[model samples]
Target: MRDDGRAILTPPARGIAHILPRDHPQRLVLNDEVHARPSEILEAPLKLSYLAVFAEGEQRADVWRRVQELAGRYGVDPAPDTANHYSANFGPFRIKCERHTEFLRLVFIVEDGRQPESFEEPALQAVPPEWLAALPGQLITAANVLLQHSDGDWPEPERIATQFFDGNALVGASIADGAAFAFTDFRIRADGFSRLLVMDHGMTPRQAGRTVQRLLEIDTYRILALLALPMAHVLAPFLAARERELAEVTRLLVEAKAPDEALLFDRLTRLEAEMESEQSRNHYRFSASVAYEALVDSRITELREERLAGLQTFREFLERRFLPAMETCRSSAASQESLSQRLTRVTQLLSTRVDITREAQTQDVLASMDRRAKLQLRLQETVEGLSIAAITYYIVGLVGYLAKGGSRAGLPIEVDLVMAASIPFVLVLTALALRHHRRKAARES
Candidate 1:
């Protein structure tokens, strides 16, 4: 405050937010990501129906539009297209939906005062049958969770197992430090839904919600991880055939002659093409399997499960059943990489062999040409010598005629002697003239 008794205002302290520019395009999204798909705070004696659908990319819009339609039915504003997750309450039930990279999961929850008389009547009964039937995509996962807080006289695990899981051996665990007990047969029932019974012993609503969410994720990812198994199985036999073919190709490569090399190269090319096709088709599924498997492990660890007396924990069950399937997938992927590398090496080797053969053929052709050129040069020299001799002979004959005419006119000496005398001189002059012409021509060239 100033001495004049007027209230004095201090300037606001500087903040980084004030200094920084407006948010980047994804700033808000990245900030909101951690809060996405938060677990619902679930109360006891609730029935939850969950479904996971695997769909093509084009079909996803239809699913989202359907979600908007459902929201309209409930008189709630629809989720925007950019939203990857949403939840809202209708009068009879609450719905939560999440969009994933390859699948869409929708969960319906119904609050109730008491447990349902029979587990068969799930919360999905409240959802419109038409909507359920018209859900766009193949149903990959479906489960019904009956969550109830335990009362006095806790039911035996075997009783709860037989009652809820249709007499299958129960895999039970006390999770979250015995705050809850979970039971499941891990078997799909006739109604195409697996059952989970969560006896919430003393967990808060949030803890129970998280527990149930984890259970559902564990199941969903378990199925997703196992999806790679069948693909691996199919590829296994194909890979074996490729291996055999590659072996034969390698053997032929070692001993193949010029004529056979081309055919062998063609075979190798076709084999590599087929292997690449398989890899392209199955690569995503295999990689997704590994990712989903890891997610399952993470969720199980978060469960912090303590073994139930006389029953296997979730991790143990996975080690015995799920791990083997995942390992098969890993092994298949490894085999593909190994085979691809071997094929590449063999291809390089074959290319080198072809190049070397072509080089040898070119060298032979060059050597043959050199030999032919030398022979042609010798023939040309012989022709030139014969031509020179002919010219010299004609010149000497002309000199002889001149000498004869001179002698006939009684000029000097005998014609034959004079002609013989001029023979050597004519030959010498002709040879000198030819040599001079050759030198001039060579200089001009």
Candidate 2:
């Protein structure tokens, strides 16, 4: 038997052969995930006080501790740390606690509501005020729900509204395919709590529970979804300022000189940094809002809502009021993303232009260096020719002096012929040695 009261059927072989493969590490946990937060069986004439609080990260540990302490007071074992849902009957009232990704939801249910009107007494009255006060997190959404029995018909819309919602216009529906009728003005009254009334027609306890969960969830997700609206409003002007600046920067890029291009690129880089920072700050918020809105839509669909007479349905009400704000948020997110991409594109284009200008300057400098090298080579060749002539002239003079001396000594030598012949040899040897030295140096370099 399961905790949900369903019978577990046994297979023919209670234990499979030992040859079977081992199960995945997370198989059992994953299999039980779908049943993590099963709806509580609820009956008519009940009052519920629901709270959705903005508590995330370290705050969640505090929340779990508070719930644990409260459970201990009632002699009930708290759920394990790995669990995200907890429910317990604490004698006076039943409490359900769920830890969501960014929020904590707690609902107190009491089956002893005797109020002729719904808001006269809420289920939270049964909770200890001190414990309630000590509960961590900022309250983001709070509502009181009255589940009362109905025969085949319900009271008139005007009467119901006047009695419970202080004459506000009502938004309601024949929900659960006519299994129940639900009504609310979606107004936070003087008590700082919105209201909902569900009149069960032929619903079993489980159906009643599912209906209440849906209603509560619709309220929760919708409010969380609207959390991004203010951010969108704040971002509107910021985005406009950035957009104008981006346009100016882009305009400057068109005709910027080399130095100016670098300056503009610097500015673009700064703008990109600012955009990325803004994205990091608001990306999670806007995306979470979108997801919450989708969940809101899904819950509304599960209600199978049909309009009641002389009132707007929940879907209609949300479309008229809530969805426009959502659209505003969506538009803001899109605009920011678009602006960021444009900023990146412009920055990249400017960077390319700057790089190209610097590269062209480098090429021009290299070309000038090449011209200088050519001139230096020509001068070096002329210097080599002069050096060879100077060496040959000196050597030939020395030989001529020796030959003249030899001729005076009566040797049969011709001074003029000897000197002339020696000129070509000296010139050839000097040129060849210079060429060899140049080739060796070039190879080493």
Candidate 3:
């Protein structure tokens, strides 16, 4: 026994083994010895699930009836509907059914229960002999039927169909594809011991159920990514086109072209509104992730790169081709409007432009004159200070000479008093002359 209390065995069949004590809540044990020799151990306890594929539009009733007959022979049930359509025992077996536009799927599971405490027990001795002999034939029969059904002539596109059966119930899958339809089938033995086959199909209710939880997880992410592509590619282009049209209309308005302006504006607004509504609807959102994953696969990566390159090319085309076209349209519209408008209106527009230019020139002239006046005032102040200094110097020298001569001739006058009196008079005359010079310079400049 393994540490987990499950009995392990390498049976007579190569690569096939039996795992007992399979009822544990935390672990699933498989019969691996049978897996090694797939052909010799057909009746071994199935450790893995099987998948069957069918072409789409194959008569649903016929397919169900055939499967029903097979299930009845094996003492299993055929659960049929628009969604799930296969059944298996809840004890130690797995079964599943799914349908797509071009294919159908059927899978089977086998369970090996916990080992008996002693091999001497009658139940323990009888268990292996009873189950193993019957299992292989049943699996083979079911697979053959599904294969035959797939081979039948049908109007749908030709497809390849295959099924997988594992000696151990842990891993198996099936695939079906036709020209118009494709789908995959998978089976898992739960880690927690349970006797249920999780059947999943592309219906809303199945998506919410436990059986399909993992498949749904993968599909959902892919769908989201795929949905974003059209937004960037298809819808973006439409929006850009509308934007260009609006830009043209605005350019025309700026040029005072009124003809058809209201109509163009109305059309552009309506297009924008339609684009918004389509975006809100987002019909492709669910499938986007799947598309993106499909692109990510090794075989499709080049195609995805090409699609992205195409998108870039389309963007360039819109900028280079459509934008220039819109500009031309605006130019033509403006020319036409100029011809249609009354002469008085055209003349008024021209007159408005001329008036604006003239007003700007007048402001420039007034500013220039103000600057020149300020400069003249500053020059006059500077010249007045220089003139005062020069006049004072001359007057002081004259007073000094007179004082010296008067002193020598015995005149009753102090040199300092004479110089002080002359200073004020000299300053006053200098100020007057500086003011007159500034006036003259201002008039000339």
Candidate 4:
């Protein structure tokens, strides 16, 4: 059992092992996650450098491959690819690589018994430049950190800023409950690197290391969070134009006919695709920025910073500049989400209208078919009546010829009367027979 009342992870007691459930596939990994990327114990009078490489997309494997190659040259054992962090001793300087979601953090530490002039002799001076050049991904953040022991008195922020930061305004504070003091201008100098100066005052190596790590983390996360700002600026006008287009589409859809609705639906579908494409491009970046910003805030809080004289503190500096930019990113992302929802609603409404239009057209066609069928039936009935009359006239003419033949043979005189009597009978019989045949055909049909 551990001091925190949690049982230490180990094999179950021998007697109980047989009854215990099998371990989960990820048990060890999950248990050790909290211990990943631990801060290395650090001493004062140290030259430290941090590099954050923006490993965008699927670059983690490549980054690891390069790191492993570098390790081989230095005769250090390579870390497993699954490791979240790696550290090794390399003669003059020590290095640590920490893997994060979108960026890889490389920290170099060197013993600085004789602190050189500011960043002129940084920890990176010991690293192979060719190796660094070959490393994948672009550098997103870089900083030179100097940790010096406080002997007599604390240095003035303005003086330190002038000497190290080229007279730029500084922001820092006494941190770790006055165990140390930190100052930085947070400006990239001509050498393309920012600087942080820390003076340790009676701090244990662990506390000093934690303080430095937090400071670097704050710097890294702050910059990372601001990365979304540029995209937000570019997206603002696009969103406005899209909103206008959506409004126009809606207005045109109100009274659209069937063919017009089809055209409008096609247009709306294209617009929706554009919106989804934009969202796909920006969504992850925006969300990651928010997460990075939150990390920055959390690390700042953990620093336990106190005012160093009347100088601006790290929190104040970032709040003044960083937070507003982060908020703009959030607002832009929110606007995009809202706009996407609006587009979906409009598309759904358009689809429903199109469906209704198709249904109405189908109903109209069905009604027309019914009307045509009625007209055809009426015409057939008229034709049947004319056919029956024609048949009756022809049959009566034949009967008259037969009666005239009989009179000529002297079997029956009065041919006109006989033909006249046959007329009524023929007419009645023809009418009845035609009506019966029509009824039979109607039943069969």
Candidate 5:
């Protein structure tokens, strides 16, 4: 039965392989992603120092060049410019460097058998001081971690925490189901460096390396996430003022007449511009903070932490201390978005009011023009009536004089009777002639 099952699966697998005509361009890269940053093999009693720098543009190139310069001292070729991660040994100490989207992380490790009386002896002490000082970009985080074997001659967590962390309340946990125990007070000492102490209970070299890496990462990401807190604090009063200004603008828009609308619109435009600028300036920081917070939580979960007596666990400390600051950032971002949306609506309303006022004014001007045109038409009609009457009177007088002259020449007619009788006729004829002339003129025009 097993043979038959294998045979059936094999045929389909072969058929499926032939089905793809060509390989995808990114197939290899995608497949290799899981193995990108393989865990290092680390024995116990090691000291590691880590640094993260926020970098951009020429600063990034500067960091790459600086690494190359350091590599030359050890006779090793530099990592390629496109490489996101690199690791190499330089006789005295080994370094692992990784490039992130907005920052670069450098880890210096001193392997086992280099035990000092104090864990405060930093692993970074082995690197060239001048070279370390010359690193590019502003420092985002710095920490030293000491990993020790826990089989024998190990002090209690209390004594270790007191000696290394200056008696601060320690957060300790047994992670990986008791494979290792971790302790940190999460405080920066007077030396300006934080400490993490990892006790290898029974973890193999690979597990130990990963464990140490996770511990360091937790600290790194925690600080990064809190970077948004200060930005939120600064923006709080600013946002409140903006909100009040927006409310005032809205009220003005409601009470606004036509002239006031222009001013209201301008105010709305300026407010919107300010909000957009704020969003543009702080968008990346807020988003990056959220991403870093998620990483912190993920690393904490991977620790699979169980609490120790008289101490808080990693999860407990983060939940109590870190989550509230993230919430503040989120609330501030929401408020900004809401304010912007309200401003947009108010601007639209004000614009509509302005358009309606313009339309009303246009209608009034048209009505006034209609009344003037009517008055002009009435004046033209009166002048035409006077012209008709004057032209008729002159023609009638001329006809009366011609009639008198004709009678005196040779006719048995009385001039008085003729003139008197012809008066009505002349009036009628003059009117007809004037009417005909006016009709002809109208046709021609």
Candidate 6:
């Protein structure tokens, strides 16, 4: 018997295998084939499933309405919102919806026992071949419904092309765009597990419901990739913008010139501070993404290699693009510095010219004062000479009168002779006396 409580096969020649010994249990041959042909023995039908996922956005109510309409169109019983009973039945398949933070999940599952003949039937029957043909159209319609409900304000379709593998086989490609994407797995061997992936974008409730539906049907990896890709797309722009901003700041740092060393240092420091923050954010987000990928898939070696390649490319871009830009900025900054220096020199020259003009004006003032002082001194000397002459005249006149009176009093000499002689003597004597008296008065005063 197998571990699953199923009967095991033994070789016909060996007869029935016995129970194992107490120590080894080697006698019991564990059957590896007990569950190998589950489809043949289980009597469950193979059916196709569909799921739609939603995220928290402006279109929550619309998504719910559309999903409900889809359920009605497909004659599927919609699941209630209870925690335990979240699945609905459509033909041979079960559809489930679940809610998550900011998103909704949907899951679909089909039984493996029997192949249904018709999806149109109310009960279990083989899924009609036409349903497979119709699935693509239905998925498209669902996307259209979502778009319409959103008033055509859906995110622009960003096509992401990727390859998926089933075990070792390169199965097929996946193209995710806008609010829809599909995955086809060619490696599925059984009808129940065969290729088919369709997802619809919606608000959080609808997305959760759709994710739950999908989780019940498809492999978990597909869901993870789907969810992660959109997130990565959103983050890519932010990351790129940060990279650009950092590059610009670095350029500014290299180009900055300080007329004063202190100012330059301050600018450079500020730029470096901002750059550090930008780089930190960039590295943290990128590394965190890499770590997340590592956790999602154990094949870290390839991811590491890719990361290294990306880093190398980034370095190359920095060297090729950023370096040149920085050089240009440096040149500009140098030009500015040269201009500033020239301006400073011109200002100094102007200041010197002004000082020279002021000095010339001061010299003119001093020269005028010196001339005035000399003129005043000469005037004082002339006044002194004139005063002496005036006193000499007055004394000479007094002498003439005295000589005339001497002639009248004495009878012996000629009056004219005496007057002439006496006048000369008197003039000399009077001049000396006046000079002495002026000197004495000047001393006393």
Q: Could you say which candidate leads in TM-score?
A: 2
Residue-wise C-alpha lDDT for candidate 2, range 295-401, written one tens digit per residue: 99999999999877788999999999999999999999999999999998998898789789989999999999999999999999999889888888898899899
Instruction: Give the TM-score of each candidate.
Output: 0.87, 0.93, 0.25, 0.85, 0.82, 0.28
- Least accurate stretch of 10 residues (summed lDDT) in model 6? 137-146
Which residue pairs overlap in candidate 4's backbone?
Answer: none
Off by over 4 Å in 5: 1-19, 112-117, 152-155, 376-445
Error of 6 at 157 (Å): 36
For model 6 the local lDDT of residue 249 reads 41
Candidate 1 per-residue lDDT over residues 1-445, each given as its tens digit: 7899999876567655677788899999899988988898898989999999987797777888898899999899998998888899987999999888888889999996887545878999999999888888988889999998787455587877667776778887889998888888788888899888888889999999899999999999999999999998998998999999999999988888988889988998898899889899999999999999999999999999998788888899989999998999999999998998899889889989999999999999999999999998798778767777888788778878888788889888677787678777877777788779878999999
Model 3 lDDT on a 0 to 1 scale:
0.40
- Answer with 1 or 3, whichever has the higher lDDT: 1
Residues 46-89, candidate 4, lDDT per residue (tens digit)? Answer: 89989999896668778887888888888999989888799998
lDDT of 2 at 173: 91
Q: Rank the models by TM-score, top first.
A: 2, 1, 4, 5, 6, 3
Supply candidate 5's per-residue lDDT for 157: 72
Query: Between candidates 4 and 5, which one is better according to TM-score?
Result: 4
lDDT of 5: 0.83
Instruction: Please list the C-alpha lDDT of all candidates, in the order they appear.
Output: 0.88, 0.90, 0.40, 0.88, 0.83, 0.40
lDDT, candidate 3, 94-198, per-residue tens: 445454333344444343543212112221122234432332211111111011112223312111212222222221122111211112222222321112112
Q: Which candidate leads in lDDT?
A: 2
lDDT of 6 by residue, 1-445 (tens): 8899999876675553454335445333345324221211111223444333434444443344444555676787654433322446566555544443333434445565543333322221333445333332111101100111222332222221121223322211111223333333223332333333233333243442333233222333223323334444444454455445445544553554333334534443554454345444443434343343333343212112111111232123334533443344334333334433443443354445446656887899999999999999799768766765666566655665666677678845565565466655655665577668778989999
After the best TM-score superposition of candidate 6, give how far the Cα of residue 253 lies from its true spot, in angstroms.
6.0
As for TM-score, the candidate ahead, 1 or 3, is 1
- Pitting candidate 1 against candidate 2, the one with the higher TM-score is 2
